[model samples]
Target: MSTSVALAAALAGFALGFSMIVAIGAQNTFVLRQGIRREHVLAVVAICALSDVVLISLSIAGTGFVLGALPWLMTVVRVAGALFLGGYGVLAARRALRREADALSVSGAEPDAASRRRSLLAAIGTCLAVTWLNPHVYLDIAIVGSLANSHGDARWLFGAGIAAASVLWFTTLGFGARMLAPVFARPLAWRILDALIAVLMLTLAVLVLLPLFTGSGS
Candidate 1:
């Protein structure tokens, strides 16, 4: 019965973690693109997956207490995150409009050692920004933390399960993206993707501002 409980907690953790993360959003889009481009794909995946692990672990270890102690912090984060997401949305929209040319440039560019190194660094920086700046991350971590603790002494195992989910998802998304390279080769696909990204980002920005709009800042 004890073994069963631990397995159950781990499975629950995996399911919840995957469900929360398997969404289309700014961070995912950026990661997907990096994967498709094969530009620092490993680094981007590592950063994203490891960041999730750290955040998840911290939350399980009582970051929620810190968040609870400073409830106003989330409000500030929400406002800043909304602004940042909105800005990125606008940038995505612009990219959608010019995707044809951008795709052409991407395809035409030659990858040299120096260029590859620069691309790797740039991709890592972008991945960090995408992962850290999004308010959704904090919310998810808090929720996951709460869920993990629900398992009592099994929460650590649960946390490990969720961390594994992060690793699996990112590894698959980053590497599996190559399989879709043929379809994305068309500039039209890139345009559509960017347009969708723009819409998603803008929608997230609006949702994040709901607290301010409803006069219930949480």
Candidate 2:
């Protein structure tokens, strides 16, 4: 690929990845919590970053064609994803409403090592589900990847650029946000964060389900 083309592809991929990920959602909330607790932060970030890598790789490799061919399958995934998001949103809202100050504190400051380990595992699992189980992620990566591949540039180079962008974006989001852990450690701050997350998750779920109920977007 021409240097100009490669540069353009990289910039485009970076913009797309950052735009999609830099939002309040389950994955971001979990990462933020882990960062505040200062437990297994790197592992959580790694899991989030690697999940994006695998998904983006599949998208670039043309596996997204399967999603295009199986329309019914995507519908099922969409419904499941919506339900998951809604349930998570409710939980977040409940936490905010309950206002359990102690529960919101940074877990495992000293003697609660076992609790910290479990929390780390739970965070990793949640991040994986939030990243992998959402049908929209597949649509974004695959549909976008397919279109980029069709643009007559070197396919491999374009795919590489996109994948690199994913890595960069997630790494920054997961780790860079650690700097704000002290601020979020405050109970009021967590309450606000959880409330915002609830709103974002519910909004996304409604957006996903509206098309299904109306049958207008299909």
Candidate 3:
């Protein structure tokens, strides 16, 4: 491909990828919470971006065809993801209700090593689950990959652009959230945030399972 065509394809890919991921969802909400808490922010951002790269690459490699051949697999994933999201939503709701448990502290003192390690592990595990378990992610990859492939010889460049978009977006969201630390200092602010997360998560869980129940492959 000529240089102008390649650049255009890459820029198009970046725009599509950024638009797709900028929406508020389970993964974004979790990342926002981790960012605000200042707990494992880099790890969470890495997982989100890296997972996108892997998924996009696999889709470009024709994994979407394999997935299409096994429609039942998507059904299984949808059910599992809905259940997981529902459980998480309940937890967020509980946190919102219990002020003592949901307090957001901005103190400079850090947790001990053991506690920090455990928290880090938990955060990483949750981030992975949120990213991987969502059936919508595969659908997105298929869409993006199909679009990128339309660019002919510039497809790889397009995929690379998508990856770049993921990295840029997650980095901005994870680090920029700290700017709102002052606003989240109050315990009530934490409660409000948790409550919003709870609602969003539960709603997403319902949406994920809706197609299965309604018999519409929306």
Candidate 4:
């Protein structure tokens, strides 16, 4: 591939990856909440971006397609993912009830009964779950993997570009969230955000489960 062709392929990969991930979804919502809370921001970002890195790389190498042949794998993921997402949604709804919970949630402050401690490790684990458990994630890998493979020998360049997009987008989302801190500083904003997160997670869980019930989109 000529230099121009390589760069073009990389840019195509970057645009495709960025566009796919920029949409509103459970993972994005969780990232936004972590960013606003200023809790475990780096870990959240790292987990999300790194998960995408693995998925994208698998896609580029064409391993992602092989996973699609196993319907049982998706079935297992669907059940587990629904349970996790439903539980998280319940927790978020509980947090929403405690309107007094501080947005900043400073340490040593009187803790609200409905509020749970948000630890870095917990955040990392949650991000990992949200990224990995979703059946939609594999579909993204399968789709993008084909796109990258289309670049033929230049697929490495394409993969690198997709990885770069993941890094840049998540970094901006996790860090750029601070810019909205002033707005989210209010307790009501926190409640609204948590409520939205709850709904988003729950809805995604239902969508994942719907396939099992209706046998569509599997």
* Per-candidate TM-score against the hidden true structure: 0.90, 0.84, 0.96, 0.90
lDDT of 4 by residue, 1-218 (tens): 79999999899889988888899887888898888778778888988998988888888887766877876777887888899899999998999988465666545675454443446557878899889987788878788878888889888888888889999999999988988888876888888888888898899789889988886755
lDDT of 1 by residue, 1-218 (tens): 39999998888888877887888887888889888867788888999999998999899988887887888888888888888889888988998997245442344557889887887787877788788878777877778778889899999889888888888999999999988878777788888888998999899999989977898766
Candidate 2: the clashing residue pairs are: none
- Between candidates 2 and 4, the TM-score winner: 4
> Could you tell me the lDDT of residue 207 within candidate 4?
85
Evaluated at residue 113, the lDDT of candidate 1 is: 90
Q: What are the clashing pairs of model 3?
A: none
Candidate 1: minimum summed lDDT over ten consecutive residues — where?
A: 99-108
lDDT of 3 by residue, 1-218 (tens): 69999999889889988898899999999998888888899999999999999998998888877778888888988998999899999999998999484556755687899998999999999999899999899778678768888988898889988899999999999989888888888889999998999999999999999999899743
Candidate 1: residue pairs that collide:
none
Q: Which has the higher lDDT value, candidate number 1 or candidate number 2?
A: 1
Candidate 3's error at 178, in angstroms? 0.3
lDDT of 3: 0.89
Q: What are the Cα lDDT values of the candidates?
A: 0.84, 0.73, 0.89, 0.83
Whose TM-score is higher: candidate 2's or candidate 3's? 3
lDDT of 4 at 12: 88
Instruction: Residues 122-148, candidate 2: write the lDDT tens digits.
Output: 777777778776767867866666866
